[model samples]
Target: MEPEPTSQRTSANNSTYSAAGVDTAAGDLAVELMKSSVKATHGPEVMGGVGGFAGLFDASFLLSYRRPLLATSTDGVGTKVAIAQAIDKHDTIGQDLVGMVVDDIAVVGAKPLFMTDYIACGKVVPNRIADIVRGVADACSATGTALVGGETAEHPGLLGVDDYDVAGAATGVVEADGVLGAELVRDGDVVLALGSSGLHSNGYSLVRHILSVAGLGYGDRSEDLGATWGEALLEPTRLYTSPLLRLIEKLPGGVHSLSHVTGGGIAANLARVLPVGNWSEIDRSTWSPSPVFRVLNDIAGTSLESSEGTWNLGIGFLAVVSPDVASEAISTLAEDGIPAWQVGTVGTGSRPSGDFESGAKGVDGGAVRLIGTYRDGAK
Candidate 1:
């Protein structure tokens, strides 16, 4: 072969790290695109701008509390990102990340103060990065949290260009005596089930598997779903912080414990917040499962027992409240646009005689079981 021109050879060789799949310039551009969104979430509490090496927030508010307790939670939007990638929709996934991380802090009755995110991808696509951050910023703003900082890592040889994963951590503050869960939950407390927006970022591995086996693609539509598979599945997780926080403030000590239903479903998660000698029997007949869940179960030939353990199956959160305030709490959530209902009640059970950790912060968890059949009617 004839020798190539020197200028052409030099130009080709000068491509630098872009040729290796990492683009430094693109990363900088991505930061620029998302800077405004990140800063938009900041209030008087956020001290520095977006490009800081570390996020700075004013903790002076903590001094106001009689005894301040800090609560932190970290989580990631699991394989659900695969569906987002498959459908080329990047916006809603960040909400899923917030739902996973920030909402966990809310379970302890904390007020979310700030959040940071981490995204890993083979390439830093500026617009895609902006889309993800914008969603995060929106959710943070709604939850009164500052989107202080984030890291977008380019993994050249690891993830594919379209492959990416997002995770985040959040910190919040509450009065020491105001901390929720096992310590506050008691017998006869009514369980209020908060409605979910959809799957809410869990059980996606099985979701993808079931769809794969059924020969369905993200673009495919079903008469049962009334929308594209991707659209139905990608419904952003409901932001429960605002309403739940309002309930806490309104009811005071009436709101005993809170549980964010996630990976292990209603029973396991609800169990995490119950006292050692107390148990809850959830009435499945209280509310009907959302259409998406019913469709998934029917198509996959999965039993309710199997699906409930993996998916939310409709309920996103549960609030264990005193019976006297359950009606008011449900009405309050309803007025806030969240459809909530009395789903069950707490009961006493024999405690196992030993000092042990109760899956949650050294507190003891009681037995929890889902009883009754699912109501067939849709809400």
Candidate 2:
């Protein structure tokens, strides 16, 4: 026993965990890189800044409300991240994440208080992670939500080095009586279609498939789109929370229900928030689908109607309101740069004989269908 073979033991222990692909140092750097952006979203309500084990938000303000209802939503940016990774653009994806998560909370007519993000990646690239978090922070700030805390996880063998996904959960507060839903929808409530920025964090799987079959690459520019395929498709989801919240406040009891036009498409989403047995005929002639929708349909040699269930078409959110205040809501949203218009009216009478989408997402609510031709003459 020559001192327990000290030299061999030293050599055997020399290989570090970093050598196994996990770099604690890189993770630390990433935290440092994203710290400022995360802190920028904080207000006086957020206690104990970033890098905390758990986020602290001031909820004492809820005491002022007669009854405060806490609303929480969690969602990811779907397959949209594929395009972001393809184009090496990490910035806008986080905005899409916030849109997916925080906007859902807004659907209940709640004001978001704070949010936390989680990033899963094969490796920690400080600048890229920072770019992603910065995007989330900016969107959170835009929606008046604090970016309290988040986690950046590195899975060396699980995900690709260049591949990452973003998800977030947000908490919001709304008065108990102010919570919006199908119960508030009336027989003649007007439906307003809030225009979407672009794809807005949904239906990318189909989009990518169509582009791939059409021999299009993310870097390829399309004259119809006025930018590279990735750039056009990567348009960040519009944060409707702030504007919609303002509209709700400005017009008391005017906005009955709000349906975020996400996955399940327009008819399904709208139907989910309408009273049971009540229905709506979404007149397509109200507005035209944007050029992006048209170009993709054209490339796929399919009708816009085909993707109706998979895409938002042009609408991003739907508002059911009293007819008296519908015009005002439209004008208010328009002034806020969100083009909105009357798409249809909730009806309790017999609907035309057709396949109406109802009970979508297991919500046995109302029936909805698209009638009339699109403004662009697409059926």
Candidate 3:
């Protein structure tokens, strides 16, 4: 009998397994496009350039202090990337990734030294990679951190061509004695707060849900928010690290607890510093929130009573500072080109009976709580 056609047999066998979706050539193109932006951000501290098996940072320079404690934080941009993808904006997430991680590490009183990122995509696109790395470089330069390296994995089958995820690790340094947390927070110490640009990485799940109900998508400008939906949602996360690092360098290590405003917002993040039964009650009226918050609030129909337990609203990073230095620190941050503002003073409390107290208002007596916590719209 004639031998079975060779082509038919090969085709039959291959059809069962199917082709892996990732395009190898596409990954190469993506890497090539991002090379320029990547090199520009590299510093002498970076031992080997990008595309290495692992990033190398020679921290001998960081060993100047007798007791150097390394502060490392790993974070992702959260669901905010979804909004970005919706708008076809990929560059800003780079800054978002770096900002999110550095904010977390900085709270421990560490000066961010180096950062590495990981980008995973189902299908690699060159310009998209450029957009992301550029954002990362901007964040690194702004935070006084070096963009040492990162990973770009194109998983066609896993990530889905249109889907991607971004994450980063920021390593910083602080003297062993300089860690800030519940230890330095005391009653009447004053909770100095800094304002946020908008929804800075957290609450996007809620933001998306609310906007969906409102039959809205990003890019619509609402009179209440004063900007297009894309503008507010894509606002790059602010990094207090650069300014805070400079200030903490001169501080007495008494600057106290740092609350990074992220997934939890002000109430939840500040809660991390609660010592034993010590409660943190913030005044919601401390600083006027940006219009974007109001837009979300209106869309979510959120309440003050619920806010303390839910979102950051406007407060970004909370510096548990002494009453005297609070103003100066805030002023110093402003001088550094950061829009810093004092929102509330730290105090003891149980919980708010009436509301989440706003602005620089809250009592530190026993049983701490915000003055007004929205409860079923009663107060």
Candidate 4:
């Protein structure tokens, strides 16, 4: 029974999982390459390490709280990954995932405890997958979250070989009374706008459309941006969990409600965290949107206001705090290097005749409107 010559092997006998498009070996190699970085995010609280069926975290610390409310958030990097893949940059995108997921948890004043990532790719390019996971691991460490486990799935036919998408889920714990939400917001509460690093993880579809219409490639350098278009667009999202957590701990009663300006843009997202029967007029003049936005709007030949429903513009996270502690909160965020400013004040008995963005994202909450022209007068 001599083995058939290697070149003479029939298609039937040559068929394998690899031939079918999945590469188990590359997946294993990816895990191996990403192991150290993943482990670096683990502390004593993380049990069973990587490659586990499920991640384990020690929850005994919650015993110290009279009542613990667990907060969980899950999100993907959105079409922002399209630019990363176009530019072949995998590292920084993971931070965007963390910023989207874990930062959402921080919106409720929760301290992220652990995170798990899921990467779906058309092919398991070991180094590329490893780079993606390593990015996730690094961000998890930065946010004090344990990267206990993750899955790298190969969806060969479903996606293009060079295409991949990353999403993650994070869990955080907060004291029952420490939960920040609309109920905690009050009349005369000052809304502090925290500056975003750039376009976080939303509105990329529009960005891509604008760039496509302008016939610009991600690799093309933008004289106005001072970097490649992709580089400017892929600027890692600012992680606010650590800083917001510090603000909460440092100024116990200074912080009340919080909002992560994502998906729905500023006013809509902020409206979600405001108490019913209350409204706030976010002053656009308080801060100018970063250049990345201005550049894109200029390319698209539209007013910045046109994308207000789709982009964060400039603000990333909004904090509604008691007026007395508003200045202290702004100064506190500044200590953490996050520029903060008063965008609006919560008010009651407001009866505005004009349209307002309220009850967004099925929250049925308060109303918000962007008043005043942008500082740069772009509106």
Candidate 5:
């Protein structure tokens, strides 16, 4: 009687998890698609590859250092992902993620060892995921970092199928004595502005606002930009890790501090690594903002003062170096194809009053301001 008549449970509706928005099979397929690119970033030191609960990496090399301090950074592409989504371009956003995460490690003079990424999307579109992971792997390889593992989560109802956000975490190591920043920065240190590739994964909220106010879409082409808005805005964030790592190694003690200019613009970021007592006046005339920035400013009719706090303007990274070695650093960076110039100088002064004196995340630091005016197409 318990056995009763044999019956198989079946639903009139062919329901599946994919029908509910999430597709585990699609996620697995994405993993298969991205495996090669992820592996390409791994070296002999990477222990276990992808598809693991946790990534394994060999830290035995750190044993050689007298005192190795690990540096870790986590960052996202921010609202810049909106631009990528609007443009339907997924490849470059991963590079922006890597740039934001790994480059911060470089600021402390650490060599990036490995990176992991997180992708949250409403649906797992295998091709799009592959494009993003491929970009991440390419960037990790370029920066000499291993892409050991990552996770892609599909949240069907929480976000739109076409909407996604990318973030990454990177770990690096530096000898304790080799960490670069405020401790090494001093008065008379020259501030060099490393030119940006474009608006490197920051200030896009303002960018979108201006574009919308001007009644422009991502596909709109501007004569000034020489490309569609999407193409211009999607410029991948420049990876400063390699060039900067080389600069630090080639000229030890020459680079005092490095500021990765992202969210808070030049003054704010540069102030982060500056000592409290010293101030810096960055000459805005040193380099012109990229056309994308200039166009947005023109369209929005925003003042440089208003934009300074939100955008990188022109400079992407600032290097504080001893004046004696400034020229060498500039020349070496130039040889590496990174255009840099002395944009300001550290001076003796008390931290200024008001918001200007506050560094990134409201940490107290020296006064920093962008003086003068942006040059017209200085390049």
Candidate 6:
């Protein structure tokens, strides 16, 4: 079918955005390069080709579900890209971008349908651009998310040479009646810890600063690392959708909450959906962190307390479900090649692991005092 006009079609008001450092020419070139990448990932659900004024998808399929809900998440790869640039690695950041997002939707039990990216570079280098695109496409393909569109930007004035930033937006669908999200999270649910592949893209700024002070090479190789520093740091973020969907489908309808351990780590992100008056007790010893966490901790001499607060602490995505189904859910993840383990449980207990003993209702005006991760370290 012929495509429709884009939603944000730009007009020659060139005066307004020109100051924002957006260039029509560079943006145009970037779009050209990304067209194929986007189209390749599209399927019948994609509403139009890449150059359309707006990205679109045929949610017509939603009519079949008794309850239909559309979920969206937008995120950026933080300073982790800086490390990738420093070490001349561009691939994994792509996975990092997807991980930062779709994982959030996964928390709500929404299956990611399509994704678009925004890349800003001071100057376009074929090799560099290709590397990142390769990363983006690879991760998109892995997650079953169609890379339908993206924005490539060139701004020599604003973006310094060899410096670029990456961000992306993902849209997903679920039956309205079947939207599994923080709402499903209850006081008695279980939290499953999915293994992280070596600091899967967060807390890198601190990591770089620590290395800078210690005169350590981010790419330095040691037996402790199993690989070069760059290789370890650049390890792509894991895609949990397939395994997660499988788990949710395999398990009965009791699976309650899902938290994508991202920028906030376990403590912050999990609390987003946790029911008020409820507490999440995450057992730290449930799974072993990959070796990279210790290396970064040692390099930065990060206090264990701070590490728990800032880093993913080796657990990337936490799946919360009814206590009885938690183990089976974790196993289902393993069946699909994802490393998962039971990390914690939900309760009406005390701080960190339980609900706020007393507090006002929350954003939804619900009585809730959310406490995730009480005082135990996931050692």
Lowest lDDT sum, 10 consecutive residues, model 5, at 1-10
RMSD of 4: 5.6
Residue-level error in angstroms, candidate 6, position 377: 15
The residue ranges of model 6 lying beyond 4 angstroms of the native Cα positions read 1-36, 47-50, 349-379
Best by lDDT: 2
Per-residue alpha-carbon lDDT of model 5 for 1-379, expressed as tens digits? 0000001012223246447666666776788888888888889899875787678888998889999999999999999888888878899888999999999999999999999888888887888988999999999999999988788877768899899988889999999999998879888889999989989998888888888989999999989999999999999999999999999999989999999998888888888898787788888887778887877888998776678888888788999999999999999999988999989899886644544544778767767877777787756
Per-model TM values vs. the true structure: 0.92, 0.95, 0.84, 0.94, 0.93, 0.83
TM-score of decoy 1: 0.92
lDDT of each: 0.85, 0.87, 0.70, 0.86, 0.85, 0.69
Error (Å) of candidate 1 at residue 65 is 1.4
| Model 1 stretches astray by more than 4 angstroms | 1-15, 350-363
TM-score of 2: 0.95
lDDT of 3 by residue, 6-120 (tens): 2223344443323644454555566666766666766787776656656677788865887999889998988888888888988889888887898788888888888888877
Writing each residue's lDDT as its tens digit, candidate 1 over 1-379 gives: 0011112223344367567666766777788888888888889988867765678888987778999998999999999999999999999998989989999999999999999998888777888988988899889988988988788878868899898989899999999999987888777899999999989999999989999999999999978888999999999999999899999999989999999999888888888898777877788888888888888888899876679888998899999999999999999999899999998888786633443223443445877777779898786
Q: For residues 83-188, what per-residue lDDT tens digits would candidate 2 score against the true structure?
A: 9889899898889999999999999999999998888888878789889989999999999999987888777788988888888899999999999999999888
Off by over 4 Å in 5: 1-16, 350-356
lDDT of model 5 at position 2: 7
**Global fold similarity of model 3 (TM-score):** 0.84
Candidate 2 weakest lDDT stretch, 10 residues: 1-10
* Order of models, best TM-score first: 2, 4, 5, 1, 3, 6
Candidate 4 residues 55-89, lDDT tens each?
A: 78888888889999999999999999999899898
